[model samples]
Target chain A: MHRIALQTLLFHRAKVAAALAGVAFATALMIIQIGLYEGLRSRASVLVNRLGGDLWIMAAGTSMVDDSELLATGAELPARAHPCVTSVRPAIVAWVPYRTPAGARHTLQLVGSDLRTAGPTHAYVPWSFAEGLPQDLLAQDRVAIDDGDLSRLGLAPPLVGSTLEIAERRVEVRGVTTGIRNVSLIPMVFADVETARTLAGAAPDGATYWLVDLADGSCGPSVARAIERDPRLDVMTREELASVTEEHVVTESGAGAALAFVALLGLVVGTVIVGQTLLSLVREHHKELGMLRAVGASRSELAQFVAWLSAFVAAMGGALGVILALLVQSGLGGRSVELHYGPGAILTGLAAVLVMCTVAGAASLASVLRLDVVKVLQ
Target chain B: MTDERGASANVLEARGVVFTHGTPPLETRVLHGVDLDIAPGELTVLMGPSGSGKTTLISILAGLLRPTRGRVVLGGSEISAMDDAEVTAVRRRTLGFVFQAFHLFPALTATDNVAEVLALSGTPIRVAREKARALLTRFGLEARLDHRPGELSAGQRQRVAIARAIVTSPRLVIADEPTVALDGPTAASVMELLREYVSAGTSVVLVTHDVRLVRASDRVVALEDGRVAYDGRGLAANPHGAPSGHDIHPPTPRSSEPVAGPEGA
Candidate 1:
């Protein structure tokens, strides 16, 4: 039965190729869409995830890392007073309007932290410099911009010393980083605390968040509770903040829903492609199928043949789709739009293709089972 | 249920078979009360003109269709009363078929096409192919074993179909116009192979309109206007034995012609 099924499918090479192309396209589309969604979620909680902190102290009701409100002056004091706290550093996350040297206007997500005092795991300041050192941001009126932001910010080859204005305060680009990104799709600017505060119109002592390092092996939840004594602030462990931020991006932002719909659309498109191919294949071979039935091929046998055909197409198409998705990810390497086709997303795509093929096979089996053996033989 | 001489058991017995198409006032009656018996170890040629229901009768005999009224017994089993699945099982185990168009699965090699029937009947693929290979080699298709139907000539394709039919060594072989598309020598060769099956005691029922093929048959049953017009041997078995410009049975009225119902049903 499998031999017949495979041979029959291969006999209609052009049609089977069309079905395979459609299946591969849909599978890659779904994988990429899901991957993009995951990339966005990861980007959304970038700061919360990458910062070397056991806990974060944010203004009350701050929903995500990118939308932090300015906390009271010295909000880090309460966290520092905790027995488990080894050090606490002020950090600021603020979005500011910027005018590039070329006079192009854009919004910039400014991140300010004292990277010198923070632990080595802290990436609040640009760790990978494309042109200059991380200490470049320590200079007065200086900010570090990522290589991805260079084209968007209208900064050409000579990135260093190119002056830009943020929130009406002129600043020079001292360093160019590589691969830093934000979900907001805005340029990311890293600077020291005072420069960020001055540009964002915050008081000298005011910070958007307080990054607290704990003594090695200290309980994070206990220390967070200690810092939560200040009613004007919300203290959470890094993991808790990252989770909440991801949830916010998925639920509140609506981007996740849109991406999920696209992923589902890929599935629906795949089903339609497979269904149409199966229908046409059965129709094309109606006389042949009837002859088989007349010659004593049972309905179950015919159904199995159809199933094997579908499985063949799906398995091959699924493997091709995974390869295509991986190629797409590789093609987009270091670009603004990040795609992460993890094992989970790839497996989901494969499973979805199988389901699509099964649905198509069952539909084709209807006509097979209803075949008129006598009429067909004639 | 036996032949005229009651020699051995009859391979098939059709008692008062009737087959109709459609329902009520719009119905088309294709076979009107057909009673036939086929003895083992003989070639019975079923002959009829267009719309005479010869195809319908063979289909009923093969259990591919059920008669409106009557019972068909094949190899001691009453097939007319069996449900589709049961009849199918019986057919798989006891019947072989050679169709007019050669209905070979176009995608499979000659060996695989012949092996398919054996495989369908629960034979392991490897063993089935071995048997198919041996059979096709006997049919002079040894050189064409790996070729698909499209790669073979009509004669070669028909040979493959024959191999597929007899692969299971069925008790009954039903062929419909098996040589209609073949040349003289090829058709003669096909007839010779079918005759071999008969000599082996496998009942062979062949449906054909050609009198040349009928002349070689052991017995011939001719149908006209949904009724049996003649059943005999030799000269009378000739389908065109009637006077020139005259039909054996009265010409059927145009209004009563079967409404193109499902294929041979």
Candidate 2:
């Protein structure tokens, strides 16, 4: 039976190739759409994921990391007084319009923090720099722009020492960072706390988040709960914030739903194409199947043969789709939307292909079972 | 027919078989109370025109279709009383069939076609292929063993089909117009092979329209309208002996003397 299945597929090379092509196209489409969705979710929560804070204190009603409601300057005073709290640093997040040398204006998110603070919360900022030292932002009116944002900022490579106007204050680009892209394509500029405060024209006490660090052996969840007792603030661990941000972006925004619909369409298209092809193959060989029955081949054995054929097509198509997706990702080279093919995405694609193939095989098997051996022989 | 001890020597027997087609208002009776027997080591030819129930009777005897009434016994087992799976198992183990179309799997080579039967019967693939190759070589298909059905001539394809049918060495071989699709020489060659199997103690029931097969057959059963018109031995003895309508009586032997003819003409 195995030999028969393989021979049947090999003998009808043209038909097999067409079926494989259909499956491959569908798999590629599904992978790309899901990959884009994952990429978007990952980027949407990039800052929350990268920030090394045991807990974040935000203004009440703040749902995502990008929600820019300012907390009072003394909001961290209560969290700092807790026995588990080790230190508290004020981090300011503000989106401000910057004017390039040519007078082209673009809105860029500004992250303000004191880089000299030797703690986990400040560690991620220095390590993220791709071209220059994080200490360079300490220079007067100095800031760093992400490598992906050079064009958006109307600046080119060799961007160090380039001057831009933000909130009517001239700031020097001192460093470049990579992998800091956001789904909104908004450029990010990292600046010192004082420079950001002066540029945004905010009072010295105004801040967006209070980055909290816990003492050794201190439980983060307990401390977060203790701090949440204050009614005017919302306290969350870094992981919780990342999770909430991802959920908020994926569900509240329509982009995720659109991508999910495309992926589902791909699954349906693949199943139909492969099922129709296999059904046609079975019909063409109806007489042969009848002869097999007359020669004592059981129905289960015939079904097994069809399943083997379906598996072969699916395996080939799956491999091809993965390769095609990787090639497309590489070709894009982070120019537009990012393509993230993480392990979760790959496994989901594989499982979808498996289900599609199994359904198609079962559909054709039903047709085979209904064939009348005596009538076909006649 | 029975021996002196009143014991049946036949390998297959049909008693009071009736077949009908279609539903009540459109019902058509094709076979009406037909009875026949095929003895061991003899070639029996079933002769009839189109729609004369020759194919219908063959299907019932082979267990491919159930008769509307009556029983068919093969090798002392009442096949008509068996369920479909049981009938299929019996056919797989005891009966071999060769059709007029020579239905060889188009994707398989000649050797594989023969080997398929052995494989289906649980023979290991390597051993099955070896046996298939040896059998095809005996049939003068050694050079064509690797050729697919589309690459083979009509006679070669028929030979392949014959080899496949006999690969498992069944007790009975049923052939329906096995030579109808071949030329004169090829047809004669195919018949010669069937005769060889008959001589080896295998019962052969051949359905055909060719008059030339009459001389080679040990018994001839002719049907006109759903019933036997003639049942006898030797074309010369039963020339123009077929009645115009149905005959229910058992045909009697004309004489004990054997008829003479060319053995392989």
Candidate 3:
């Protein structure tokens, strides 16, 4: 029985490939489309990872430091008194597009960090070194530029020692960085709190948020309540902040909902294409099915054959689709657009592809339901 | 051979079967009324030219087509009144049909095609494959077991079809021009394979335009138009069992003009 299932699918290997190709196109399109959305969200709040803080304390209702603002609040003081406060850093965002000394130009987000534990905040752009020398980015007038931004600025990649013009002020590119793409969607240059405040022309003591890094024993929920209890400010964890960003886009910017609708469209088109392709294959083999039936195969066995074939095709198509999306990732180079792919999305895409295949298989599956040996023999 | 597998006589009894095709202007009744009774284990040959209603009669006998009005009983089951699906179920376990074209599935190997019916029939995979291989080997096709129909000669493919038809051990086998696709030797070989089932008491109903099989068949039924022109014992036209009415040419060659396409009849 298993061999028959294998042989039946391979018997029309071409048709199976066609069906899978249809499904693969859909799965790939949806996955990559979502990848872009995720990439955009990551870029919008990348400062979270670098902030070295498990908890972000900010003025009431402060949504983002780069684009969001809040009135002066007591978000900084009490967070420092907690036993979990290994360290706290004042961080602000200053995004300004500037040309390089090498006659190239692009935008970079300038993030400030506390003189202490600043590496976790902005220094992560160069990538946090678990085993290498950490870039000391909080040096007075020194900043760190990402490898991607360095290349874009007409400078050689890994540009460890270079100069960046911080709005008519000279700031040395002290260290080259990595991982800037995951969060900023572009490039980032990190400097000390003093330098960032100077560049943005803001008051010296004004930090939009206090990033508090917890000690090893601190419980996330307990610390969250402790921080948010400060009446003067609100606190958001990384995961909470991400969901909020998604909610904001879904409800406010409409990007989240728009993409969801497109993804739904993809499902419809994909299922229709895959469904028709498989159904036609079944129609072509009506005589064969009759022979099988006359031989004594139950309707369920026939349905199994259709489903297995459709699933195999859909899975293959989905994998190829993902590869295709990755191929086009570089095409979005200049648009400050990026794409992210992780195991979670991959597995989800796979599950979705299987579902799509099952839907497509419904058409071919009709043969099992409607076949009558008497008609086929005629 | 009168073997144990040869069924006791009286396997099928058909009564007053009236068959029609299509509706409106295209409507046509092919069989006014037909009746037949066959004993188990006997080979029944239905011989006639195109449009003589031979195929239609064969379909009715095997319970593949519905009679516009009539009751056909097979192995004691009144199948004419059954629904299409019920009829197919009855056909699956009780009857088998050998087609003129030897319609073996192109994708499956010879053995798989033979085994496919067994698989569909709810036979265990291991047992079904074993039986399928044994059947193919019995038919002198062991060498071509894994070859697809497209890869086999017409005779070999016909033998595979025969194996597939008989693999389920149905009580009756109805063959419609089963050997037409083969050359003389292969056709004879195919006929011999089908005859082997008679030892198991399985009745064989072979329909053909060929006169070659007329003499060897246990019973011969001549279909003239939609009605049976002749049904006689001992197969041969002669009552003495010697070559009867020996002639170099047919006494009356009915209009040889091709009446419809090959599938039409």
Candidate 4:
């Protein structure tokens, strides 16, 4: 029976190929859409993911990092007094409008950390220079721009030393960093606390987020609970803040719903195409199936054969889809848009494709089972 | 007619079989009180005209269809009383079927199609293939073992179908117009193969309108208007044995006359 299933698929190479293509296309579409959604969510929380913090202290009702207002100066004083609080640094996060050399105006997410913070590399704004050393941003009025933002910022490659007017302040691009992008595709600029404040026109003591590092072996949840006791502030652990930010950008902003619809459409289209193709194949072989029945094939045997064929199609199609998705990912590399194909996404896409193929097979099997051997034999 | 070798030797028996078709408002009776007994080592050809219910009776006898009334017994099991699954099991284990269309799985090689039967019966694939190869080799299809049905000649395709049927070593082989699509020489060859199976103690029940098969059969059962017009050894030409005789059972009295029609027409 297994051999029969394989032979049937091979015998109708054209039909099987078409069916597999449909499944592959659908799977690829799903992978791309879901990857885009995940990319968006990742972008929404990229800053939080990079900033190693036990807790983030923000102004009350700050749903996302982008929309957060400046926390009052010395807002970390209360958290710093707690036993679990080891140290706290005022991290300034603000979007500053910049006019490019091409005269195109755009908003850039400016992140400011003290840069001297010790411990893990993520203890401060995590920026890796693509063109120049991290110390380049230490120069007065200098900031680092992501390499991905070169075209958007109207700057050419090796953007180091390029100067732009941000918030009426003259700032030189001292280094080009990579992999620092937000959901808006806006370039992210990293600078010292003084430079960020100057770019955002904030007071010397103002900061948007207080990046809190807890003492070793300290519990973040307990520290966060102690900090949130103050009604003037909202405190969240790093993971909690990342989740909130992602949720704010994805679900609250309607992007999640739209992407979900596209993914569903892909599934429906794939199922219909594959299902119809398989059904047609079965119909074309109706006489043979009838003959099988006449020669003593049970209904279960026929169903199992179809299932095996469907699984084969799905497995092959899923592999093709993954390859195509990787190609798409490679094509989009070095661009402002981010497409993520993590292991989770790949496994999910494969599972969905297998399910779709199984559904198609079962639909075709229903027709096969209903076939009247007596009529078909005639 | 009763089997001279006794009931146990009878591979198939039908008693007072009546089959009908359609809803009550348009009910049509096809077979009326038909009875038959097929014994081992004999080739019985069911002869009838087009619309004479030969196929329906054959289906009932082969356990492919249930008669509206009356029972059919195959190899001591009352198949007509069995459920669909049970009948299917019986067909799979005890019966082999050859059809007019040579319904071989088109995608499978000649050997694979034959091997499918053995595989279904739980034989390991390698052994099944070897058995299938040997059987086809015996049927002079050794060179065409790997050829698909589309690549085979009509006669070779029928031979594959025959091989598929007998691969499981079934007790009875039922054929419906098995040679209708073949040339004279090929048809003769197919019948010769079937005769060989019968010689090995397997019973064969075949349905055909071809008179050429009449001379080769061990017995001939002729049906007309659904009822068995004749049940005996050799071709009788007429139901009553005379070449030009009238109806064997005088027409039923007008008040008791039963209506008859083709089963699938």
Candidate 5:
């Protein structure tokens, strides 16, 4: 069929392109705006996602990774005894500084784990670079430095033969790996349980928390019941821990509010921009539209033409915005601004399209709807 | 308002028509009970002075305006009391319009501009374009089929407008002051095109104050101060009529040189 919509679109592509560009920018900004919060929250709790444990036993309200100090490590025995709880590990986590042989100091999330029961907690850590596992880490003063920490140590990347001084103790950097990092942009340092305890001068009787893992599906309630039998323990499954983490990011930190503000600003700015551009174009074409109506084009046909133009531009802007975001964010500060595409991003973008395009179209319609076809018959 | 039954083979007929402009309190009534009939296969010129309601009368005859009191019938349908939708349907199905300033779409191809009416009425694009091309060819505009309005000459643009109007094969073509900008010869050729449409059996109701146009007109209705002051088939008025304020409300002749080129040799 002859497409009045397509004809009009071709006629107005320049104005449409300009309008769509605004939406594209808004899309990019909205993504990046939300990304800032995601980025910061990821920084605040990198250990949650990366922590290999299937369940976390922390203080009742402590969800943030850096919220608590070492309690009693023996807290795991109660949860481990549950029929649903197959394994548990005692893990030590702290923020500390280390000086490499190159003499540069960098902060690290120093984690200590027992080599034997480490499957529940330590599996997520990058530990292959370490010369050995949790062989009394606080005993011998040996250290496992992440490649990022090693780079900051100015040691020219990881070398098994290097040494470091952490917590006023000299230690060998016997291993190197990736993906282990600290909250607030720090690197990670790994050491054996005993050696880390000795190096940090920690009391062995106290532990960070018991990292628990269940065997299979539907084990959460039974594990919770068994762990609750102990007054000192609070058991949370993986999803629950994630939820708590989300709550921490949303409520406890101001980052969430700021991101929301920026996203809203993006939408408003886009609405203004898209609305202005479309309305101007509509004004320019109002006489022509009047002529068309005078000659027998229906109001529905005109509306369809306009709506299709908007949706095409919006959808194009959406796709272009996503591509541009990825392109620009990848090179930002030599670091990738992470884009997490869940179902929510799609919904958010669609909302942006509807809000932006509809507002723009409505603005244009203010003038367009009055196109005195009667006045224009000549 | 009532249709004039048994009306001659005229494509449009107006009986006792009255028209007014503006809203109440500030409104000015223009036309006062005018009567007219435009026969099929004939070119009729409607000429009048500024504020004389010639454009208003033409607008009513084209089914674009509903007369306040009397009836104007187009394509056998009385239009004075019809709703906007019904009026539009009659115009789309039976009427074509050619204006002084060619209203070719500035962005569309010549062929596409001609084809637009069919598309608005749901004609498939390919066939509509094919018909548009054939119409342009008939008008000797085939070579400029892809040119936009901005690219065409004054005469060519008007030709394109004529092609666009007639491409839909409307039985009635209403033209309003089609030569206010053209030289005498160009205007003459434009009128010749209207005459060609008449020869092809399309009725034309042309509104102009330019007397040069009356030569091609089979019948002429001269309106003055909102009434039909003269109605005949004589071509003997001012051999060169100037622009009416009705179309382009004229200024004080601007050095008496407002007329372009020469009048008829």
Candidate 6:
């Protein structure tokens, strides 16, 4: 039966090729759409995700990293007093006016962290620097910008040492990072807490959020609850904060619903195309199928043959589809809407393609099982 | 009534076999009450005009159709009473078939086409191919073993189909117009091959209108208006095997014309 399945599919090269191509196109579409959605979610929570913390304390009702009121003075006191707390770092995140070198005005998100309190790799600091070091931002009036934002910031490549103004205060670009993007298209600028406070007209002790690290034996949920006692502050574990931020952004932007619809459309269209092709192939080979039945092949045996054929198509087409999606992702590098086709996305796409092919194969198999052997013999 | 060989010796028996198309008022009867017995080691040719129900009878006998009434017993199993799967199993174990269309798998080589049946019956593919190779070689197809159906001539394709039919060494071989599409020489060759299988204790039921082939058969059962019009050992006998009245002779040399009505039901 396996031999028959393989030989018959190979014999109908044109039809098989068309099915494969349809499956590949559909799989790629699904992967790419899912990758884009993941990318969007990741970017929406990029700041909170990259900052090394087990828990976060912020002003009450703060929904995301960028939209938060300044925490009341000494909001970190409750978290620091807890025995499970190792350290609490005050960080400043605020939107500030930017004046490009071309005299064009724009708004940039300013993130302020004290690098002296933690190391460059495992702190509330962004990594993947294209040039310069995290310590450079610690210098007074120095800031870091993502290389991806250079064009929109009106700054060219080799951005290190380039000067720009934030809130009418001149700040030198001391470090450039890669892959740090905001879905809102707002350029993110990193600086020390003092510079960010002075530029954003915030008081020296004001902080938008307090990032908390826990001791090895501590549970984040317990510590978060312990700190949430203060009525003016809300606390969340890092994972919870990331999830909430992602959900908030997706809901606010409406991109999730739109992308899901497109992905669903791809699935339906792919299923229809592959299903119709297999049905037509079955019709074309009706005589052969009838002969098999007339010669003593049971319904299950015929179904197994169809299943094997569908499996082959799904496996091969899914693999090709993933590769194509990766190629597309690579091509879109540094673009505004980056795509991330990780292992999860690839597996999901393959599963969808397999289901599509199975549905198609079963439709054709029904026709085969209902074959009229006597009529065919005549 | 049993012949000299007795009913116990029969390889197949069709008792009051009847078949109808459609249902209720829309029904059209194709076979009334077909009673027949086929003994092993002889070639039986089913003859009839168009709409005479020869095809329907052969279909029922092959277990490809369920008779509306009565039962068909083949090789000790009542196939007409069996479910489709059970009848399929019986066909696999005891029956072979050669159709006018040859129905060979177009993608497979001649050897693989013949090997598929043995494989279907649980023989290892390697062993099945070996057996198929031997059978086709015996049938003078060794040179064309690797050729697909499209690459083979009509005579060669028929020979391949024949090889595929008998590779499993079934007890009965049913064929419908097996040589109707062949020339005199090709048809004769095919007949000779089937006769050889018959001599080896495989009963053959052939549905054909070819006069030369009919005259060569050991028995002829002629159908008319969905009933057996004549059943005899030789065409020279009268209808119903009585030695007296009008005799059934072979169709004239222009045998392309059917023996009775137009060809097929």
Q: What is the C-alpha RMSD of each candidate to the true structure, in Å?
A: 6.1, 4.2, 7.1, 4.8, 6.7, 4.9
Model 6, A287-349: lDDT tens digits are 776777777788788777778778878887888888889899889887888787788898889
Tens-digit lDDT string for candidate 2 (B70-154): 9998766788999887887888887888888888878889999899888988999999999999999999999999999999999
TM-score of each: 0.88, 0.91, 0.79, 0.92, 0.85, 0.91
Chain B TM per candidate, please?
Answer: 0.85, 0.87, 0.83, 0.86, 0.83, 0.86
The number of residue pairs in model 1 that clash at the backbone is 2
lDDT of each structure? Answer: 0.82, 0.80, 0.69, 0.82, 0.69, 0.82
For model 1, the docking class works out as medium
Interface RMSD (one decimal) of model 5: 2.3
Against the true structure, whose TM-score is highest?
Answer: 4
| lDDT, candidate 2, A256-364, per-residue tens | 8888898989888988988888887777777777776776677776677688888888998888878888888898775757888988877888888898888988878
Top candidate when judged by DockQ against the true structure: 4
Instruction: Indicate the TM-score of model 5.
Output: 0.85
- Interface RMSD in angstroms for candidate 2: 1.4
Clashes of 2: 0
Q: Each candidate's DockQ score against the native complex? A: 0.56, 0.50, 0.31, 0.62, 0.38, 0.60
Q: Write the per-residue lDDT of candidate 4 for residues B226-263, one digit (tens) a residue.
A: 98876545432223332212212222221112222122
i-RMSD of model 6 (Å, 1 decimal): 1.1
Tens digits of lDDT, candidate 5, B177-198: 8888788887888777877888
Model 6 chain A, poorest ten-residue lDDT window?
A118-127
Model 5 spans > 4 angstroms off: A1-17, A34-46, A99-107, A114-122, A127-140, A149-155, A179-183, A199-201, A215-219, A222-233, A332-336, A342-347, B1-9, B22-24, B234-265
Query: What would the per-residue lDDT of candidate 6 be over residues B1-265, giving only the tens digit for each residue?
Result: 2458665567788888888889989999999888887888868888888889998998888898899998899877899889988999988887888999999888889999999988999999999999999999999999999999999999999999999888888888888899988988998899889988987998898998776666557777788888887654543222233221233333222121224322211
Please give, for residues A69-120, the per-residue lDDT of candidate 3 as tens digits: 5326455666667776676667777676667777566777776666555333
RMSD of 6: 4.9
Location of the lowest summed lDDT over 10 successive residues in candidate 1 chain A: A118-127
lDDT of 3 by residue, B23-141 (tens): 97898888867777777777878876788888788777777668898888876678898776676677778887688767677778998888777877778777988999998998888
> Tens digits of per-residue lDDT for model 4 on A1-378?
678878999999998898889888888888888888889999899888777687899999988888778877777787788888777877778988988887878888899877766346445564666777666666679888887767777888656676888987888878777877788776788897878878877778788888888886367777777777778799888888899999999999999999889888888888888898888878887888887888788888878777877878898888898888889999998776788788888888888898899888877899888988888887
